[model samples]
Target: MRPTDIESLIGVGRPAISSDGAFAVFASSRPDLAADRTVGQLWRVDLAAGTPRRLTRGVHDRSPRLSPDDAVVAFLREDARGRAQIFVVDAGGGEPVQVTDQPGGVTDLAFSPEGGRLAFSARVPEPGRYGTVEGRDAAAEPPRRITGIRWHANGLGYLDRPAQLFVVDVPATDAEPFYPPAPALDEPRARVVAGPATQLTHGDADWSGVAWTADGAELLSVPDEIESRRRDLRDRVVAIAVDGGAQREVLGTTENLSIASVDVAPDGTVFALANDVGEGGVDFVAPGVALFAVEADGPRALTDAETIDLGEVGSHLTFDGDQVLVQDRARGRVRLLRVTRTGAVSEVLGGDLEVNGHAAAAGRVVASVASPESFGELVMVHGREMRALTSFGATARERGVVVPVEREVTGRDGYPVHGWVAVPEGEGPFPVVLQIHGGPYAAYGVHLFDETQVLVDAGYAVLYANPRGSAGYGRAHGRSIRGRMGTLDFADVMDFFDAVVADDPRLDGDRAGVMGGSYGGYLTAWIIAHDHRFAGAIVERGFLDPAAFPGSSDIGSFFGQEYVGTDPARIAAQSPMAVVDRVRTPTLVLHSERDLRCPLDQATRYYAALKSGGVEAEMLIFPGEDHELTRAGRPQHRVQRFDAVLEWWSRHLPVG
Candidate 1:
């Protein structure tokens, strides 16, 4: 897969099925190389017809949802100015009607059960800020008082503004749609879609994950409450009555475990995918998100602690009649699993594919699945069987994208390590790239990974492994490296890499290059510093200095303390920056200018250290990009980075 091939890559988001199980709607997107941005549209597939149909002409439509009556399709769309708002169209397909003209734009929206009202969430900036007439630009606004650490977030800069819940009544007739001018957001719960939508939430808090009860009498959402400022990813689910828009019932901490997402059954039973803490904070690795049923009686575990972890990344837990549906990750493949109140867990759809997401209604199910050779595609689930509902990635597959051949080897200890190698089409002696994944907790799974495919296309054998400290192998493996990032995890990585290189004659050990991002970037630096087997190394957005990382990164407070340690000596020992002088291999440091996850200082400091120490090194930074540069940054940036990487390798460790 060449860098430009990504322009044809397809991404299918989570599926939203209709109440009657007749059809499913999802947001399908792809990169527009000419525009340097992503273009998306809503699509619907009729179960009976077994075909997919385009439903919208939007350029960035997402979060496609069907009304309870299946007559309306609601989704979020970004306008010409890049501000998102809610839009609704007939299920049969027609011109969409804009429902909200929110200034900050809507982030999440859901249709009420009665189909007369829509509940959504949007950021509310101070009256004089965020493009308001009082202050067209943030620079012109009054000086803001800094108060909390969570005030800033990656991607969306300064998050001091509160995001509240709102309700808008859809026009009952086919009359012209009403879109009121946004009002000042000075008061709590002030509606951004003022005049048309009624405000439901207030205060300085942000509300998200909005859902409506079956009766449409109340709405449930997770609020970024006070405790969240001190506690990472902390949240409390609240139920608000729609009548008075005042009555609220707070569901406190779920048995001390933080909730990632929650879904309410028609009977008021709350099913959630929860984990240890910190929501998805980088440091909250190891423990898997378990399924829980929260009710008046108390919270009950519905997933087996010994072998269940419904990954919370996209696990939109939902009620499929008496059974609950979630995406569970085990042994690398993310499978859709169903659980009963009695703790009887069964796999609804399991295979070598990663079930990115799943949704079911009226006994019918649909999911977005990805394999080792595909990014994402839609599938219909029928009683443990899955059938292709879309051929989105057929082009890549037909182009002969190298599929990673899976392998497992025993580590230094008795632990068995798992990984994969995608060999380029060549004869013998292929230069190798050890691709490390970010998230000391994340694993290299049997999914189509762009990094592996891109490197392999350049005639380099890529070895990407999920050593210890990676997920999908269970919490034990993940927790092994907690507070010891460079210990067992590093050993496991080396052991697996060495084993694969020794067994595969196609791989050349001397010409090997180590490269990774985020945590992977850290490990790459760590590998080149401690072990001098590589001729070149590329560290992209690495977590270099732990002590300094606690404040600069968004998840600073909890990430470093939990993932590394409090001991100064241990932190120094594990940090690559602490031992930068030991590096011998020529290296390339790539970073994003606006990266809040790792920050640009990490790359700058490391590059300065390398140059000062007389090591052959270079640094490249992408403007206006964040930590997700490789995954979701601008298409142009991604292609440029790929080209830079290939050039770096060509100069240092050219393929034989």
Candidate 2:
């Protein structure tokens, strides 16, 4: 998918499921609207009727969640000030009641098992650097500084202040800030589940992908961090009980397991997907992906290792205490299957139902399914029957969209570099865009709702190749570029392009564009800085100065010591900024003003250098957005980003 067209189906964060499993809620763009202009709205569906319904009419609403009792839906909406606040709306559709009008925004949210209480994660605004009242509310004064985990931090990327879950009693009458006063330490009140939501773990532990047990007493989650030096995606599954104090890790990183989805069986057995540690570190474990279970004895591999490679990225593993529901996307299409405790896998539904996000409630599973519709439908599945609960599917499927061609390109080092190439619909020569994926750790795969389809539709051939250091290729392939920065990855992109252009004439070798975000951004900038063959380049949220990034970026450890080597001297040599003056190609610098991953400084420095060096360069900055702006920011900003990037290519590599 081109970046612009994928914007409409861009789904991130977590999906919400109704208590009764009748409807699912998700955020998606209106297909009828232009790329640079529409807002994401909450839509619902009648599982049996397969009819989608719009829940919110606002221009920008996101992270829609259903209350425990299913009467109210809580979500975050951007205000005029650009701060996101929590709001509650009746499921039956009406004016939403504002919950938090404060400046500091709310990030993560959840509803207590009982409708009596609402549990959510929020960041209370802190005063400016200089303020008279040290701990004052500052509500009476204009917000001097927007303080919180989601907001952008100056030197230190996005400081994801751990989302401490808070509980506020559902007021008998309408009330603002729906958040109740801090929970009393000594007394156990009915307000919000107290200590359980607080620091359940120690030492800046990141808690995400939270799934509640059927009884809500135990919670299963994946706490993960990428070990850069070792180049490992490490994660542990911990079980936390409401009455228990500290969480216990049942699954460790011994097997190179990065738990993506976990569903606890009625018997307390946790089912997850894991891989075996092979040669190239985590990369060598290609066949390690499989469905597994953990119980009193230990973890056991459930799925047959020979039958499938076990897809993990787009596929989610869920168990109903007995049967497991997995949305497998490894085979190019989304397939739903039921796995019994005996390890017998039966296909439930398999077609073009591209499931992006999913959740299981009681006896049914709710998922975000996209097809030809502009918006994704909240699909519900029960036993042998499947139906769409929401009618928000796209009005008409856009045809002639290019399907990516998946294959392998030989790396300069002789190893086959695996990647996907999307060609535009044309007979003659067409300009090409070398699209790089983020997550020097993440691999480019066949996942749905990707935003890179725009370039191909506009008559530009797109190539997304996973060079050395990308996950899913095996450890050695991923670690091949360690301590080498732009060496191996740079060669891979250039060589892959050579092969593609040699094989296809539609690809105009003379005019080419390079684009990527985060690590991809770094690669894009590095490409233009070191090589001038590209006609134009687009770098989004990528690092320029490796030295400055060590202490400033969120995952400093990712590139600082891991990929670029720990020594400051070595980092400087590998930095794109150190050699930016060499760049002569026209470049478009794009980043969220508040992006934490690469930070705005990375963009500004490169932009200034390009302009000062007499190079054609432009910077697109979205205000008050973090690293996820492209997928989760205000709808307008997302649209503008696509239009701007496309416009840059139009001006430089104009295709008639």
Candidate 3:
């Protein structure tokens, strides 16, 4: 599909299934709604009648969870700063009660089983210790100064606060500035009650997907080991006590499983979709949407499917009182599977099930389906009758256009490098945009356009390839660029470009340009430094100097240790800064000012070096944005980002 076509079919929002299976909620960016932009709102679909009704008029609501009694729907709403806040609206749709007012916002909310409380994740507030906290909050009897001497040690240097979890009363709707009493070393006590927030699995490790036990006394969370020792580290599920006690490793590392989507069965069976790389590499690894029951022994894998990889993002295994609902990624669609304890997964419903949330509730089964072309609908599984319960058009639009064409490029080692040739809908021999993806570990799967589509629509031939060090294919291919970043990865692109031109003479390789964010951005910088194949390039939020990142970025140590080995010297060797002097391409260094991952200094150094060497280069900084530049920036800012990229590419690779 062309970028404009992809934009037009920005399909349904992610559907979420409520606890009771009575309602399903999802978001859509339908042009039929307010603006053509993505507006995430909550919707309730009746599982019995299969009728979906829009609830919560808030424009950008997401991640809806139904209360146990089905009376309330708790969701996240974007505030002024675009930080998501937890909001609660009635099932019938009413004024949303803002539950969380934290600075960073809340995500993945779970209502207490008794329905009297809510547990969610929020960035620990770092209210800076400024002037004496005198008359600020009326919630405090006598407004007092909030101070922390060692807040900086915890990375709260800018703020006079510490990182922690907070629990307020259920409908804590009253906007009151209440600062908890600071912890005194003499009588140190955590402000966030462990029992309330379930501080299981301590450390600064980022935690997500918290699911409460049946009794609500415990919780389940999947946390990625943020240390970053491996390229593709898999997350594991752990059980934590609500009382902030010890955590149990319910899952093991042997599985090499990154639990993508998880659902707890009615009988407490935890079903998860995993990229089982246990049998050596991802190629030999079975791509499984397996059913595992948590036992005293550990997780017992049950699904018998072999090699069929489940779509990690949209795929989930929701347990009905009797069966489980899952989206069949192997089939490029969603399916309703009824799995018995005997390990039989029955296909109850088939075809493309388009809905957003696991947001359907009924007696035994809950269903949701989503499509890139339409708004996801709540599906009802009643005695073999499957139907959509809601109507939501796809949210988010695409301004770029692209046509996917497969091309095989030979790498430096004579290995075939696979890629897709995405040409915007226009005239012949378009100026090429050599777009690289991040992850140096992730893949540019299938044909979905978000940012690059815009570039193609701007009349550019885009080349996206898996040059090695990318996942999905296998470990050998995934690890090929471990120590040879610019070497093999760069060759993969060169080969892919040559093959694309060889296969299609219409591609104008002479006017080719390059751009990428993160690792891809790193490659763009490396490409300009190593070769002059591209006319111009935009290095978005890239890591120019690996040496500087370790001290600043949260996972600095990991990035250096894993990819380049445990030596800082080795990291410097593979980093783009090591060869910045050779760059000749007109490069636009774009970065976020507050990016915690790559940091802005990388861009600053690259820009400074390029200008110092008289290289044609410019730098654009997005304030208040982290690693994500265009994805999370303000709408106007995002548009400007596309404009800047197009302008840069247009200046170099003039389309005619």
Q: Which candidate is the best by TM-score?
A: 1
Q: How many residue pairs clash in all the candidates, one count each? A: 0, 32, 48
Error of 3 at 614 (Å): 2.6
Extract clashing residue pairs from model 1. none
Candidate 3 minimal-lDDT segment of 10 residues: 148-157
Question: What TM-scores do the predictions have?
Answer: 0.94, 0.71, 0.73
Which segments of candidate 2 are over 4 A away from where they belong?
Answer: 1-41, 55-118, 124-162, 168-317, 326-354, 360-365, 370-375, 379-425, 443-453, 471-480, 485-488, 529-531, 567-574, 578-584, 607-625
Instruction: Identify the runs in model 1 with alpha carbons over 4 angstroms from their true place.
Output: 177-195, 226-233, 278-283
Q: Report per-prediction Cα RMSD to one decimal.
A: 3.7, 7.3, 7.9
Candidate lDDT values, in order: 0.82, 0.65, 0.62
Write model 2 residue lDDT over 1-656, tens digit each, in one string. Answer: 44445444634324677666666666655532354444667776655555556788877788877876778888888776666767778876776766654344566555555555444444432334113355644356554343322333343333333333334444432443235556677755433212222434433345554555556665566664423244455567876654444576777766566565666555556787766544333333233467887766767777764444455455666545468777554333455667787778887666655566667777887666655333365566677677765544232234334457776778677977777777766686888889888867566655443454667667788888888767655445556677887988889888898898888888888888889988899999888888888889998998778877754566553446666777877887788898888999888889887776776787888889889999988888888888887656656676677889889999988987
